[model samples]
Target chain A: MSTILECKNLSKAYGGKTALSHVSLSLNGGHIIGLLGPNGSGKTTLIKLINGLLTPSEGSLLVGGHPVGVESKRITSYLPDQSYLNANLKIKEIISYFDDFYNDFDKARAYDMLEKLSIHPEAKLKTMSKGTKEKVQLILVMSRRAKLYILDEPIAGVDPAARDYILNTILSNYEEDATILISTHLISDIENILDEVIFIKDGQIVLNSSVDKIREENGKSVDSLFREVFKC
Target chain B: MAWNLNSDRPIFMQLIEIIQISIISGKYAPGSKLPSVRDLASEAAVNPNTMQKALAELERSGLVFSQRTSGRFITEDVAMIEDLKSTLAKEKMKQFLESMRQLGFQKEETLALMSKFLKGDHS
Candidate 1:
């Protein structure tokens, strides 16, 4: 398998606070990888660095063996933890923006998802509920045929029904050769879809392994292992 | 019913079992087209790659066959289905016998107890 994302001695700090420390990991294409960590454990920091929104303070982070820049950004479709779509823009306009920005964007697919969810193209984001807005944003992100997908806390703050919808959409839509890195602390909710998991705690990687090996050797579910490992 | 996974085992193995159950139980009828890998994955709420791996295993076992462009279909051979059904039954019966033996019941006594229960004659 081709290596999609690689990090070596990657560290990030904000003033005196260390968000990530000596994180070295490599991810290959064609798998759903879980970036598992608790709140403020540098999940967002790592994702941002990969997307070129933040620079690593200490070491190298490579996407397709290229440093974070335009090429990497072009291939990476990112869904940030917060909404980045303009509130005043109608759903169609956001679709148009993505279509213009990404050569791989499939407008029809995005519209198809919106239609399935009963979202009108003319509806403005400002008028929608938080969950609705999030769904729209997700549709936009998943519509792109990018090489890597970085979804930050996709299921957080959503009801169970909505979470199911989100997971289903992701499972059904992503490109075959693409690698999806979903960062969330909700291990149980997203555990089934993950091929491998990377457990981060206090700005460092603790465990990184395939999901099956963890289960076969440990005789425990990922959720159970996560709870035990991160017990307070 | 939608597939459910136990976290302590490899998903590929569990998926193979679930898909086999579906095939033998007639949830996917013989010769009928199977859902695309992505559709099945979404239905089972699993990754498509894992689902594909399981389906490939099923194909290798002759329980399913794939045409390059037309997608996969359940095996059309009735004998194959019957074979799988008996194999599954044998597995269940063996497990039951092992448990009964662990409880110190001889084969004859276990058979008697099972027949009594099957007859619904408990009073």
Candidate 2:
């Protein structure tokens, strides 16, 4: 598999406070990678950098062999930690909005997920619960056929059932060769879906290896290992 | 079918064992088509690469075979399944005896106890 995203000595600074230090890693295609860290550890910053929302302060950040720009944006589908869509729009309208915005958005896939989740596209986003809105947002994001999907805290706030639905939608969708980089502190929930995990702390990568390697060598799950590594 | 996995062990190893049990126990009947790697991965809630590796291992062991144009299928050989079942039982009994030995019981006494349990003893 080819490399989809590569970061070399990538750093981010706002004013004098550095949110991310010199972090370096290269991710290959056809993988579900966990970008795991506690809160305020620059997971969101790294995701934003990959999504082209912020420029790296020092080093190279590439998506599909090119720097973060129009090309990278075209290939990367991003879901931020907070809600980004308008609450005033109906679900159907939001679907159309995404359809107009991203060329890779698959309308059929989105509708299929909506139907399965029993979400009415005609219903107003404001009328739904927070979990339902999150599900809607997730469905829209996963329906894209992008090369790289950078999801920030995708399963944090949702209930267990919705989390399963979101994970299933994610697994069932996406191209086989595309890569998914999901950032979250909820390690146990998403650990099963991940092929590899990159454990970051204070903006530095602490561990990067295959899940099987970690389990076989340490005889523990990623969640337990995470607790041991990041114990406060 | 649902896949039950413990976070303590390697996923590929558990996946191979569970899938083998399914095949041998007729949950996935002989000569039947198996799910695609992606669907199976999603069903098992594990990585697709891991599922692919397990299937490849099964294929190597003659429990599974693939048709290039279509997909993988369980072996139609009932003898092979029976052979695997016996092998698994032997492994289980060996482990059982080892645990009994750890509890300070000899093999003969353990067999006698097992026989008594199987004999419908109330006490």
Clashing pairs for model 2 are A92-A121
lDDT of 1 by residue, A1-232 (tens): 9999999999999999999999999999999999997788889999999998998999999998788998888899999999877899999998999999899899999999999999999999999988888899899999999899999988887888888899988987899999999999888888889999999999999999988788888988888898899888
DockQ of each: 0.77, 0.82
> What is the DockQ (computed on Cα atoms) for candidate 1?
0.77
| CAPRI category for model 2 | high
Which candidate has the highest TM-score of all? Answer: 2
Residue-level lDDT of model 2, residues B1-123, one tens digit each, is 347889978889999999999988899999999999988998998888899999999999999999998999999998999999999999999999999999999989998988998999748
Per residue, candidate 2 scores C-alpha lDDT tens digits across A1-232 of 7999999999999999898999989999999999999888889999988888888888999899988898999999988889978999999999999999999999999999999999999999999998998889989999899999988888888898788878878888878999999999999888888899999998888899988899999999999999999999
